[model samples]
Target chain A: MVRNYLYILTGVLFLYACGSCGNKGASGTNGLNDIPDDVVNLGIAEISEEAMQGFVDNMSSPVEMAALIKSLNVGYSNKYLAPTDKIEDYTTNFQQAFSLGVYGLDLGYLNMYNKTNTVLDYISAIKTLADAINVGQFFDFTTLKRLAQNNQNLDSLMYISVHSFNQMDNYLRKTNRSNLSVLIVTGLWLEGNYLATQVYKEAPHPALKERIGEQKIIIEKLMIFLQNFKSDKQFQNLISELSSLQEEYKNVSITIELGEPEAVEKDGMLTFIQHDKSIVNISDETVQRITQKTEDIRNKLIRK
Target chain B: MRPYIKTIFIFALFLALARPAFSQDISELTAQCAASAGDVTYLKDFPAKLDAGTPGGKPPSAKYSMLLSKNTAYRFTICTAPDSEGEAILDLYDMNILIGSTYNKATGKDYPSFDFKCQKTAVYHIFVSFKEGKAGNAVGIMSFVEKL
Candidate 1:
């Protein structure tokens, strides 16, 4: 049976790759770049004074910036979002904006670290700066979905997630804890898989999902690190957020079970799509506690 | 140049219709592939030569210098790297001849069957790339065929 299946698959591939199958017409391209700057503003995140001085001192050359972006895995790939123009925008301007955002913070943080020599102090100050900027509310899930659907500025979404991971990596490095730094790096790898899966699940495609799943083991390992290391502040923040999100997920699970929206009231709101429309439902009290935990992390960032 | 453009456009029209219909058996085959994030879209030129027999993930390093012969039917496929698993737009040319093209979202390691016929034998080039980044990813290609 397996041999027969393989033959059938090969035959199908042969027929599909050859001229026997007709063309599937091209999808419409995302129109030209008219995205406004305000849609992607780098908010008021305070960096350490030493970090800022360091950034100014080490003014990155274009070559260096390009290399950094490439190393961070922040380039456009033609295999996912297309017509080529969209990819170009992502690989170009979006990358620039992200570099600007992270560097702006990195410079300040470096300065503070050099001046104070206390990593915890730097983290607190940085959190205070992040809090002032209201960064968390910048791109909600809905905004992200819209960008992915329109194929506009999706790279920004990617940049933010990866950039955040990089920020944590930098923090871990400053603390001189090589072990936690590895965990942070692992999280970065896993986050890519998570983003790909989230994108594929919204729009069902076997090939795309399969492509996303190719990196699943890495992502699962990242999740394991997040679960295991609770002392790391950044990991703690991510875990808290993921836990709250899990509550939202549980509401959906309950809906799937009981056939109707449950009236459970929680502090955090979970929204999922059903039949092409977004359905919002409240979470249970357990979910609320998770939300509180997330809020606490957010508060610490703001206070610091 | 304008007239040459018109001639190329008109020839493209003819190639589009004649190859798929009542065309004679041909020795050459045509194919097209789109760009992948992994496919090096930033490349300004094609590899010197490509041998289909090499293996997967190993593209030809040499640029193609030969064109297709007249009366040859070709097969084309489009795909993207998993990171770029989505829509891919393809346009084909044979030494400035607008041969044919197609698109596909069925992401895999291979392209879809959107084949065409070649009416001339010369050193032809195929250009494949995408405009989007981190999402609409694809790669496509065309290959020759023979009867033995």
Candidate 2:
């Protein structure tokens, strides 16, 4: 029954994207003044408190990590991406949702490098998984494919694609489906970190190493989000496994120095300059532990 | 001869056209707003939910809480519904202290976006409300420029 409702909701949502809508004050049961019942019936994601929502809001998108990898100027490498063919093995909603996030970041990585040729493969995989979970409506495939084909407008392509995922994430949470949101976010971060670790192993850069170590802070926040659904068996398994990584992260520490913020007017906009500095300390042993544990967790997620 | 068939067909057509009247395209708003943040490498954005207003009252304000990492430069941009009657204002705050605002309330001028340079890495609030007690559809995008 839920699946049937979701299908209807997807269809209605896709068809309802032309203008502005309100979730209130319909004049009659079938009045034109009201938002369609199927849409309103798409109950908000079951967010119990503002804190959980905060966790979702506060968690960083994989785009930043992917962009950082690109900054390394090492050039694009296919080995860093989650295998595109791995999409089919993820048949369950949990698997599909998680891999959707994994691939979303992969798409970002591809987008950053002007690697337009390969972006479609990841997009195809993302569309498949998104459709399986009934959230494909948020993806504008026709427009996105068009954008992907024209590599000159990489900015437009990246914006549309990322914006679509953000909308899907919002829809899931609004419909009380934070369970899926949790998995998607986890998969995104996991793949991002996985990429970072791989890059660091190949060429040890202080910048990349510091970034990888600083993920300790993000992992703490992610753990809190997962614990929000610990009662679920899958979430429980994730928490237990990730907690080990957290324990390993405990071996690392980050220190910061305060600095003054400078505000300047540029191009008729206010641009503030932050002056704080942070130092991350990670031992060789801790790095190895993190690399091993992260790979293990990711392998389990993909059933590799 | 086919009155009922014609009625059903008309109803379906109305449904198709009427959707925009009742829907706010958050995705498009976010994308457009993000694009407007020129030259700033993209990071992430916070999508705010603006409620439909009551007959005459102001729509409830939307508050987005975020962790603005210290030493990082972030920008907040907004794009209100194309058909909106007024602009929505974005105000930045920390523990009730007014850090900055997109609209100069004193001057009655509005800006589409504003940037923040963080001296402290802590959770801050990005409050969204309509100007002059008015309300309508809008989206606010937060992006990173640099982390110092």
Candidate 3:
């Protein structure tokens, strides 16, 4: 009887272990479904979804941009953010997804300045847009609202808010809605750049200027991803609009110099010192042109 | 016979209780790891649950591609799950080159996290794995340190 009981217990453990193994398999390609049937059938050859995902994934987070702006002592301004009242105007999934990105960046900016009071408006807007796109499950609005109400939990709020968006993006890509994912990414990039450029117009910080110029690399990659979905008229229009902005970026030059890598172990933490340095050369004239063109493109996208 | 049945029932109850308790521990572990990132702005989290590979084979690892900007300081933090026996290591690579790692092989030491001051605007890869091909679960967090 003892032996029999032991056998049963071992069998139960084996099954439990097997249950955990279910997650291992080929990654689902639900994202491919987002591609238009025409593009797939016509053999126009869209970039692999995985490659596109990599492009979207690598874009710098808006929070980083907001943090840098705050670090430069730039005062928080609501003028730079897409107005929350216009959420209803974003009827189309394209517009909603794009606006979601815009508001997401705005939320980052607000959080950076510790403007928790105004955060609820943006959070509501984000939740509405996310729900419209069927990715609302990722955001816990209740907890976010609670966190936003308390300044002490700013770090937790930031982490949860960023994590929520990351989870939503992953879900969108995992499902077949990468098209929306791309738009969100583009929207975030546009808003982040817009905030930086607009602030530079007022403050004119050199670090901020160089940061704006660095978008030359980012826009190049973003354009490639947008071009992959050029089969759609919306994407085509975006590509056309961004092409002008991309042209403006041509004047901004960036070059890198490799340096010896050094590693330091301090207080049980490893720090890898990057020796490579990049030289960004952008004239004020070019920045002005980029700024004007960024405003133009961003306005067109956000306008009702 | 009754005693044997009681013993089996108790064992089953323990198994049911342990699963959720372990899951809760992992959740707490992940939260603690995220908190350990300090005042840096959180960017993304990479959750990896990996099993040991074949004997004498390369250890399993999770790889994520990130677009790191030029002149930006980024921090990578790793935390092993409570139930895991293996300690997780994170490696940052630019293409084929290994640029940084949490563990220094020669010194036989492991660090909880590492900071990378990226100098180029390009796509980089991060790999997370356990030492010596051991099975484990861990959460890797990437946080923005500052603009360097």
Candidate 4:
């Protein structure tokens, strides 16, 4: 009887574990859960608490970290939006607009994530957005789509994720303890570059290469700050896993051709060939690669 | 065992509760007063709930007194709905200019804000109301602010 009772108790515990840990249900599209909780809070903290709730004010969905930069009044020279103050408004508005423009993909990704709250959902939404791009539903912003086309599907997603992560990366590097920030940013930075490589293989864009090079500069700066966290196990493990993934995608390149390449500038919009469509069609091999990286990172973080 | 599980669980539960609670914070009132037709006023007895679902519902209506300023911009922003069935309409007038009007299907975000530049500084009367027929526990007259 004692043995039977023990068996029953063990079975109950097993059942609870299984039920609690099963594939988290379809979280819609945003995959917010995949992000570390502290990261999310910190990301939201980047946006001002007052401005955080006013999505309609911007006429666009919010990217928590990016929006936080606006709320910090980091770049604002003038306090209010009176027409009499041209220089301040021009500088502030231009900076705000530039941030908004640069964050298009990030905002879209966040919206897609909020609309659907899981990894698969986010992937699905990206695929849908890709399909929309394929069908010409996107506004023909020459430069924006041009930046997107370099990676095809996964590449753009990677870019969006990486760039968005970089916003936090920059903030963390600036405000927080250098050691902890470097460890986390380095992991995300490598992860960004790794994912970029996969998209690069599908489609190649020279401008994206330029951006990637810029990202490298940031990463190198981060590396200098890494020595402090060298002994931290979780940080070390994440960094190692991210490095491995980065190494795997090291050679992959994304190729893109702007329909009117010369007609576009960072200030302009252009027609972009679909580079990321291939993500929707990624094969088992690609799945294995991503899953391996994801699992390694998860294990490192989840372990006590 | 992770010590933070219950803490995280309770926190999550609290946020889930807070989201709905915040959305339902809007209220409709009965503050009606007499002023010129162009004047805008805050509606009294706001937060009138709208219908449950399926269109063909009336937007909530409220009369405001001396709420409209001649040369200022006024806007309405909504916060919550019981379900998906609620609808709100906002109309703006400036010295009979019929400056702006909008309608929105109730979701969790603010909506239907009307904007127009005011030409005069006199008090202007404005009207806001729900569609005559609707059903649901929707919040009405979420909030309105007029800026000069």
Candidate 5:
């Protein structure tokens, strides 16, 4: 009897472990198989869907731009942010997802500047948009709101807000809603660029200019991502609009010079100082054109 | 009867020990990693779970590609799951050349985090793997430290 019980128990444990392993394998795939036929049937051969998803997943966070702006001592202005009142205008999933990214960047900016009062507005707007897209569960609004209420918790607020956005992005990709993820990313990128360009127009900081010029790399990447979904009419229009922006970016040249890499260990932490540097040769006229184009694209998208 | 009771107890012990390895929550692990990021502004995270490599073969690693702007200081911090047997090592690479890593091969040391002062505006790769190709779970967090 003892031997029989042991055999049965081992069998149950083995079956349970196997079942868990099977589920992990199923979820590990990019969910390409579960994607709707219309979505994946398009000729997306130039870049594999997984690669595109990875690109989208790894794009820079908006908070980095906001932090840079704050570090530059650029005065905080609510004028550059998308108005919070327009959330209701976004009815389609594309609009909501994209605007969610827009508001998320704005929230990051507010959190960086300790603009506590306006933070809630963007958070609420984000929550509404997140819920619309079925990703609201990631937000933890009550905790976010409480954190936002205290200026002393700026770091915590920033971390939680950005963490929530990352979670939403990850969940979207895992469930095969990468098209929506792309829209959210585009919206965030457009707004961040718009803020930097607008600030550059007024402040004209060298670091800010170099940062704006670096958008050439990002816009090119975004254009490729948008093209992957060009079979959809909405994506087609986005591609056409961003292509003009990409054209302006062509005039901005980035050159890389390789240098010897150096690493240092201090207090048990390793630090790498990259010797290879990139030089951005962007003409002021080109920046002006890029700025005008960014404003145009941003206004058209947000206003509609 | 005594043998049967002992067998049942052993079985329960095995299940208790193995459950955490399989059921560890990635979000919780990621939060722990984020905390290690300190006051730097959080940007994004790369969470990976890799199985051990075959004996005498290449160790498995998870790679993520990111665009790092010119003249910016970014921090990369790593946290491994409590139940994992491996220590996570994160390496930053440009093209095929290694730029930096959390572990110093020459010194045989491991750091929980590292800072990369990126001087280029191009796509770079972040590779995370376990020491000795052991199966493990880890989250690598990229945070903005400053603009250089």
Candidate 6:
């Protein structure tokens, strides 16, 4: 998706870098110093700091999610993942950024299942997307590829990949490219939700069921961010797509009932935990409805 | 042109020589703060820069937002370069609601770390900065203990 944005950037550079030579209204070349700043092509939006922070707290780590699913012993299915061949189809910034995230979660899923053979395809695609987005400096593709090639020590691979992503996320925020950050996180959340709902449909488990319902809250935050950039036609479409999932989740309520709290000191550290339990009251019909919406949105996202 | 080249060459040399020192200072202090946080598994640490020279609403602050799962306990270890002066403070906030802080400035003491027991699996925010709104560098480390 990001490759498409290159054309827009080239157009922008051509308009601005002409240095007034092409700004004579088709009559004659203007002087170097007379270039207008408002010459009709400086359109782009950034993710606000507040919305970026929301994404930071909002996304559950894909690796962690995949790890959970692995622990549950669910069989892996590539059918649920965005195919590697579709990598080149995503040409726009929106498609690239969002699918970068989708593929990221898919990588985690593959890693969790120790599917080493399929991992390189994802790393290459992710690297291409990262380079397109200009955050490729932080993604150590060589190191990561080496780890994947080794494939014996999974923890090291997980740690390195997570670190690479964390650095990218931080660098993006530091440089105020929160739009890309948000898209990446959005992809992660969407794919993670899709995986859970898919797995839950196959095997009904309480934990996974709760996980699906709890996304109602996450989807609500995601909707708010998507709304922030609704000026973009694609974001508007995304908002529309997620709004359906939100509708299914509207009735899913999570209430916290406080339990006994205790404080214990271990190794000179004061550790305290509130024994509070959260009850997610979601209907089975609601879960099915949410599953459908999640699949729809996720499929729409990865369909290209 | 010859003088200009000599000046540029000197400045370049200085930058090359000083770059290591600068990295050493921040990285060493960060490692110190991180090591002091105790036996929990080390997660990723974020760099923080607090400065008085920054413009409005600017302070060297790092905000970490992540899920602190319910029935799970987490410990946040924050180390600042100016901790000797009790300047670095880390605060835990839940969805815009201020929960707690590292140094209860009222007590004039800085705890190297703080623990949080999540009652609900919700997003939690960790805000790191220097006390008194001063300028400095710092790091915050998060880890889970006894996932019961």
Poorest lDDT segment (10 consecutive residues) of candidate 4 chain A: A271-280
Worst 10 residues of 4 chain B by lDDT: B28-37
Off by over 4 Å in 4: A1-110, A113-172, A183-228, A231-234, A250-287, A302-304, B1-148
lDDT tens per residue, model 4, A74-190: 332111111121212212211222222222333333332332222233233323332221211122233233444442343234334433333332233333223323333343333
Task: Give one digit per residue, the lDDT tens place, for model 1 in A1-304.
Answer: 5555555545544443342123211111111123332321211122232432121111111112222223334433322211111212322222223222332333222221222222223233223322222222222334434444455543333333233333333333343232333332332222232333333434444433333322222223334534544554444666675555344334332111212211111232111111111122333343334334434433332211
How do the predictions measure up, each by TM-score? 0.21, 0.79, 0.84, 0.23, 0.85, 0.76
Model 1 ranges off by over 4 Å: A1-225, A228-280, A283-291, A301-303, B1-148
Best to worst by TM-score, what's the order? Answer: 5, 3, 2, 6, 4, 1
Candidate 5 ranges with C-alpha deviation above 4 Å: A1-49, A53-58, B1-24
Clashing pairs in 6: A1-A90, A1-A91, A1-A92, A4-A91, B49-B60, B50-B60, B50-B135, B87-B131
- Locate the minimum summed-lDDT window of 10 residues in model 1 chain B: B23-32
Q: What TM value does model 1 have?
A: 0.21
What tens digits encode model 6's per-residue C-alpha lDDT throughout A1-304? 3444455445544544442232121111221122122211111244555656555453656655775666577889887777878777877667777888888889888877878778889989999987766666557788788888887666556655665677667665655555566778889998999899898999887877877877877777777766766666777788888787788888899998866656565775655566657878888899888888888888878855
**Model 6 chain A, poorest ten-residue lDDT window?**
A34-43
What local lDDT does model 1 show for residue A103?
A: 29
Ranking by DockQ: 5, 3, 6, 2, 4, 1
Better of 1 and 2 by lDDT: 2
Q: Give chain B TM-scores in order.
A: 0.41, 0.78, 0.83, 0.41, 0.83, 0.79
| lDDT against true structure, model 4 | 0.33
Candidate 3: C-alpha lDDT = 0.80
Model 2, span B85-146: residue lDDT tens: 65787888765766777777776867887888776545678778776656467777787676
DockQ of 2: 0.28
Give lDDT: candidate 1, residue A183.
35
Clashes of each: 69, 15, 1, 66, 0, 8
lDDT tens readout by residue for model 2, A1-304: 5555556545554454432323321111221122333222322333464655575364555556666666667678988887887677886677888889888878888887878889989888888887777677677777778878776677777777877787677666655667777788888888887888888888777777877787887788888878777766667788999999899999898887756656566878866555555678898788878998998888788744
Which 10 consecutive positions of candidate 5 chain A have the poorest summed lDDT?
A22-31
Interface RMSD of 4: 21.2
TM-score of 2: 0.79
